[model samples]
Target chain A: METPCLVMDADLMEANLHTLQAAVNRAGKALRPHAKSHRCSRIAHRQVQVGAVGICVAKLREAEVLALSGITDILLTGPVADSTRLQRVPALLERAPHLMLVLDSHETARILHQSLAAHNRSLDILIDLDVGLHRTGIPPCDAVSFARALAAFPTLRLRGIQAYAGQVQHIRAFEERRTASLTCMKEAGQTFESLRRQYPACTIFTGGGTGTFDIDIEIPALTDLQAGSYALMDADYRTVQSRGCLTPTHTFTPPLRLLTTVIGTHHPSHVTVDAGLKTMYRDGASPVPAEPEWSHLSYEWFGDEYGRLLTPPGTRRPRCGDRISLYVSHCDPTVNLFDAFNMIRAGSPAETWPIDLRGCSQ
Target chain B: METPCLVMDADLMEANLHTLQAAVNRAGKALRPHAKSHRCSRIAHRQVQVGAVGICVAKLREAEVLALSGITDILLTGPVADSTRLQRVPALLERAPHLMLVLDSHETARILHQSLAAHNRSLDILIDLDVGLHRTGIPPCDAVSFARALAAFPTLRLRGIQAYAGQVQHIRAFEERRTASLTCMKEAGQTFESLRRQYPACTIFTGGGTGTFDIDIEIPALTDLQAGSYALMDADYRTVQSRGCLTPTHTFTPPLRLLTTVIGTHHPSHVTVDAGLKTMYRDGASPVPAEPEWSHLSYEWFGDEYGRLLTPPGTRRPRCGDRISLYVSHCDPTVNLFDAFNMIRAGSPAETWPIDLRGCSQ
Candidate 1:
């Protein structure tokens, strides 16, 4: 409830939820909002209330936390390799009952099967396919064999495939992003079709993030869209152009922001704020001042705990104790830095939501 | 306890504690290790046991966490701007009777005085001076006036000057780092001399990080060294060359690491690990494989939850489920991402130490 805290605009977030869900529904696809972005079960519940089929998490710990928070439906998009983490999956399944995991290799499948077999439980498994990201997933050529191998295990039920083109999610050019996303979706569609022929039981096909959700919704291959950042857009995502659009369409308002107070004004050209890399995520870009009056001032990383705002000549300089909202470069990692979100509704502080999965990365 | 958790080598960390503390002591300076680096009170307690006179924290929340963990002497190196945060300072002072805060402006001093005056308590205040970082702190020319303004408040006790040259802490050239640190120290010394002439009670002159701890210990102006990274060297600090050393001298072995498991091995040239920017800090650089066998494999950010290891021809390829330790790029932010440290002792799993101040960045 103070400076350097994560602030969420309830109205803007609600608009994002309704708009994106409506778009996905119009495209005849389900929306499984990725909880890794906000990491708040309250937000996830809101997404579910807005007509989300389920939620997707990136780690077992995230799944466990969401499950404990009473989120019964969860699809873990990332693979769990360590035996200790794999062992926890069955326990999570008992709580969330509708938990599904994504797998890429036979070795991981074997481990998951063994762990679930010991618990006398079965888990839904999705074959992750490599769709030009070259990050994770098995190749489409190997999808059939991988699915068959996973299906052989009685403790595992073969779901569809997961092809996420994360690298192309933030392409600046609208046509370029659309082309890249369509190409990957086409490949994933071919793989899903091949797998569907082999095992008719395969139905769930999920992938795509906030950057390509609109494009992905148009793809018949993706059964559900896993867009996480749309609800709380950041500075980096705001730069991305929509399909056939040259500039950011403002389809989603940046609901999440970092509230910081000016702590020092030692130099004539710069002032220091309380939030820096430690409080805000510094992956894609530096945070920008959200106020229109401070648009000329550029933000720079002063230290781990301080951010320096470069005041150009003739620009209105910030004074000590002045509070300002900063649009973060990235939202997911920034949300992970804090323990709770100071929710703002109707222009005032409403309530605080715990980032239940804040440090649940193990 | 599990893969993707932060691991600390106890032996290496202990050696670093003794070596750095002995170095500072030999130079006739007290060591107040910065808890922002590890955020674990157990490690801070170990540093105190090895001769650290006090500890340095970056936020009021961190001060409260450390004080609750029984670390009574704490110097909060960052300024608190918000009224809500300033009000918490008195509560922290109750827990940490020897609590000190750094201030840069008169506005902040007045706020602190007003808050503390209500509780009939006085706090030790250090005038933060600009040491070329231009991040936080008053310029040397304004130091005397600022100190006088702060001394006018009965609730505030002017302790000394805090001149931290944070920018020069990671300079690759040893002479460059030393020269920059010395130049700042000289200016600070001049300011301290001026302040001492008026108030002889000013004695606690502190500033300098791990990169310049040896250089700072030699500066007569600095009464104590605030070296946090010395106890747990990171990949970025390891690149800092000593006074005349060409390569990184093992002043401190990188005791902290992230243990990740190979979760996907679809491509022959690349494999995906469970830890990425989310699990490991990505401020200074990307994490590298710790083992010699995987030295040829370079690490890259695959996504939020996955790290891609690029294995060139002739390099040993990792298979799915193979766990390896990764040397983190930065220790402070990386440690802040975890709830606890999986401390390794004598090549075995040891006791866990909670990162008590992991998200204590209010």
Candidate 2:
């Protein structure tokens, strides 16, 4: 394989898929893996084949790509307000009839309804409730009023609610993560209950990530889980302990690894690799070398296309032309940087999956 | 304009081009604007038209894109070592006769030469020297020896030296930045002086960025500048004081702004904008609202698709659907996230420029 290649361990990936699917299944909740992580249609198909209710996407562009790839049931997790973007909904709905969108504001709901009414098409939507992460969504306190106001938009059907506690996804301790997740999902559950009273048909209450997968299942209202990152875990999630395990063991192995060649070895105490800030997303924890022997060495950002592996005393210094595998800090944005993922089955090349939904953050 | 749109102010961009080109012209040095910042062939062509000798790219993929777009003279600034990538040189050279590549290691030079020799093609090469940034380059002490070793490869023609001090590019104080840049460039100049003895054709001593454009020109051995971010100034560079002025001010105006819409207004003390970590690059500094009136509001990352504007006491919160323009923290990676630049000329829509080399980080 070429340098700076994104490789996925197929065997490990398959194991991770089954592990997460079984966990969600045992909890009696649907698994809707977020496509934002891998952005590959092949992976989405695999997730669906292994019993996924549907796939969740943060952008309409992702939903459109996955829908065109024959994904019947698709849900857009983020709020879509712009008229230009909302106009793209009907075409997407035509491709994926079970397409669902999340709406947090009345103005957005009204505009989306108006856009849908023009085509005489009605769409299913989830009221995005802000549990704790104040990025988007209606506050849990206003969920009842917001769901009631949705009566004005007859073209938009109130399906359920989406309250993803993104901020609580990476809490290190299992207990702390469960407590934080329960606090947020409890409020979301109450809001869903209130909405279910008025609209008894509202059954889908989805929102949970890889960190709080087990804890979120405890909430009686959360019917489906939006757990991304479990399929191809990253360095950031490796620290989080297993939810239902007796010991502090990671449930999912990091399948995604960036293969970067050492381009420069001029620095006396370090070697420069091709993967840097541009190659691996550094929005969260710093990326580490995948090899256990290189654990002692620390990674540093050299530039956009270069990173440095600091070689302390007694550490083996990597030479020029040496290829190093790296566990990315964040998977979503790092996967977005690549064109395709080189699938490795049993440590050998299998097939390549194009990250078709990449750069789909529209 | 649509939400989360990348807009380029044409007038301001033109002014920035002329200002930097005129500065380099006055300095008696060539300006080879780094295309890695904009990654648009149109912008690269404009820079060349404005007196830039050619363009500098950080990756071979970028070079291929620019060469395909009819850019003749192109210099790839980063080191290319992998055999697979080295095999691509001859084809690129066919498109661009004056294409130059930077090499820091003899192993890379040997491999690159072997690839070029098989195709019976010779390439113009620059000995990349590591002045301070421990990225990709040979140490100044090993430059002459490394350049001498290149004599073993007849297919590679030694042209000049490339010593980019990316570490000194963002120093806030002009004096401190000048001192740091000079310390690095002077060493590079000395190395160039030693190499010129054996290779008389080694004239191009290109290495300088937007931060140290003025100070680097003070070094007589420095032949050209590799300033990339000057064209589209970012929030990080805006903090840098001007070089040769009595008054402290930013020489180039930030022409690039990310236009985003307020997607949610559910948070009592804040409004959520559509642009987030996936939209803006937060590697160096935080992106600020482009509008001066909303300068008091602070921006926070919401998630992949949203950001929160902290609305404190007495500050008015933006409503849903309202557009908020943001000044990106870093221009290069941020530009890589977008597909096109919505060109705005005199406050009116002009044309769109495709970020053709956007994801060319291989």
TM-score of each model's B chain? 0.97, 0.96
Off by over 4 Å in 2: A244-249, B244-249
* lDDT winner: 2
Query: Per-prediction DockQ scores?
Result: 0.73, 0.67
How well does candidate 2 score on lDDT at residue B203?
A: 88
lDDT of 2 by residue, A1-362 (tens): 77677999999999999998998899888999999889999999999999999999988888999998999899999988777788889888899999999988777788888888998899999998878887787788888888889998899899889999999998888888888899888988988998898898799999999888888887888999999899999988876778566453478989999998887776678888888777787877788889987788788887777788999977788877788898898888888887899999888998899999987877
Assess the local accuracy of residue B284 in candidate 1 as a C-alpha lDDT between 0 and 100: 80
Q: Give the per-residue lDDT digits (tens) of candidate 1, residues A1-362.
A: 66789999999999999999999999999999999999999999999999999999988888888998899999998877666678788889889999989987677788888988998999888988888888777777788877777767889888799988898998988889899989888978988998888888799889998999888898877899999999899989988887667887588989999998888877888888888878887877678888898889899887778888999988799988788899998999889999888988999999898888887776
Q: Point out where model 1 deviates above 4 Å.
A: none
TM-score of chain B of 2: 0.96
Clashes per candidate, residues 3 or more apart or on different chains: 0, 0
TM-score of each: 0.96, 0.96
Report the CAPRI category for model 2: medium
Model 1 C-alpha lDDT per residue in residues B148-203, reported as the tens digit of each score: 77767999999898988888898899999889889888989888988888998898
Clashing pairs in 2: none
